[model samples]
Target: MDTHEAAGCAEGASRRSVLAAGALGAGALGMGALGIGALGGCAANDAGPAPAAGAAVGGHAPGDAPGRGRVLGPADAIPVGGGQVFVAEQVVVTRPAADTYHAFTAVCTHAGCLVANVSNGTINCACHGSSFDATTGGVVNPPAPAPLREVTVTVTDGQLVLA
Candidate 1:
């Protein structure tokens, strides 16, 4: 080829390479922006009322009430190594031992629906079959990726009260 034509062809190839690099850079930037948005969305939230053990399907914390809550005593109310659903307060209080108790929301974190059942040591949300560990409130399964909301529980005079 002629020297002039060869130089022109090299310039065209260089220009195309720069454009391709720019496109890749733009795509990477877009992905990074999306990742940032997702991180912000999941940043800690203190945005709402605390859920309770027996509040309802959608449990709310004792703080939601103007007056303090009425605590219920143990004394065989909760079966040993079993849980009791307080539908009124939307709380599930379980007694793993005579002195050890665990409390979490009765509602499924996925859809805000009442957990259908607690069986085999896991709380089951039938709405989507999402399961939360009854004692720890950890997600045992997906579809409901977030762990079940936990409540601060206090035992006063054998009565379990949300603190």
Candidate 2:
């Protein structure tokens, strides 16, 4: 073959290799991003302590109060001085004192993990050992940089509903 033709072929091969390398690099970056997102949602540093014995775990019951927003369950399901985690709804309802209730998002501020349970006057996240005050939703421990976000709740006909 002519030298010019050989040189052209060599250049084409070099371009193809460069393009392939770029594609592989892009794929790796995409996979890394996906892995980080999955970890944020799924990683729990430890399951942490099991819910304190007989701690409240609220669930919806039939004929609960029908309202303008989501029904969390009967208000009585939340133990006084403790709370219940509504995992599917991403909420926590606490009855810190009789006849009073508070609510907050279950998502942890540290890494987007869900808060696992409530006990000892604090809401707890298993992912990073962060805790928040059950009554005020204030941060009580770290690795968490912020408190859980408060969610408004109301009791209607003895059922707790999102407000």
Candidate 3:
């Protein structure tokens, strides 16, 4: 082949190589960005303890009475030996005895997911499969390293009130 033609072929091959390298670099960067995004989502899920145990779970502290102490519902909404999760209030109220009741924050200590359900005397968190005792808020299953935060509650005028 002519020298000019050979030089042209070499130049075209070099251009193709450079473009391929650039595309590979861009693909690697995109994958790295995706990995970072996934990690960021996980980190957000594990941010911190939901709310303090002693107070209302969302935004009210224990003594933020005027703002936080809304009547949850009738005391009987919680069955004897079982509990009810109030997602709005972020509290779980359990009646372990005939006239006794207990309240705890619904936030899971492991990954900050709300405790989803109460069954068979246990409060279950769906996110990471953590279980807590309905009566005492103690951890029953692991992935959660701590007990749920306890909240003081009282029955007033047949309604459950956060204290």
Candidate 4:
């Protein structure tokens, strides 16, 4: 090719590279911001006194009570051999046996993302695929490093309340 044509192509390629680098830098910055935000949220969550169970905390599900010591509906809300996630309270309640229930923090100990689902006697965190035992809240998968924090629960008059 002619010199001018080759020079023009080189300039265009350089521009593309510069644009790609700018985009990459912006993406990195965004990811860094996200990491910071996640950590900040974790800190805020840790700073508080667990929101007093029923207080109208941020990210609470609709229809949740708005007072201290949250009332998690009926005791039967958590089916036998299954569990329920109370996102507002950041707690998970599981029933491993008849007339018995276990409660633990839903926050994943690894990265602070709430545990997503529970199945087959395990509370699963979708963020990094960590799993904890539904009955004991013990870590059942890697990357968790610790068991979920146990939350005291009591069933009173057919209603479940955080104790």
Clash totals for all candidate models = 14, 0, 0, 1
Error of 4 at 65 (Å): 15
Q: Which stretches of candidate 2 lie over 4 Å from their true place?
A: 1-26, 29-37, 41-68
**Count of backbone collisions within predicted model 2:** 0
Candidate 3 lDDT over 1-163, as tens digits, reads 5331232211112334334554666676844543322221011123323333333434554323232578899998888888887766767788988899988877777755567778898988765578999888899998888998788888999999998
lDDT: which is higher, 1 or 3?
Answer: 3
What lDDT score belongs to each candidate, Candidate 1 first? 0.55, 0.63, 0.64, 0.64
Poorest lDDT segment (10 consecutive residues) of candidate 4: 4-13
Error of 3 at 99 (Å): 0.8
Off by over 4 Å in 4: 1-35, 38-68
Q: What TM-score fits each model?
A: 0.55, 0.65, 0.62, 0.63
Worst 10 residues of 2 by lDDT: 4-13
lDDT (10s digit) by residue, model 4, range 1-163: 5331232211112334334554666676844543333222121222322222223335553222233477888998788989888776777889988799998877767655567667899998764578999988899997887888888889999999987
Quote the lDDT for 162 in model 4.
85
Query: Clashes in model 2: which pairs?
Result: none
Residue 87 error for model 3, in Å?
A: 0.7
Model 2 C-alpha RMSD vs. true structure (Å) is 17.2
Per residue, candidate 1 scores C-alpha lDDT tens digits across 87-143 of 556567777778877877665566454555566787775545678787898999867
Instruction: Write down the lDDT that model 2 would get.
Output: 0.63
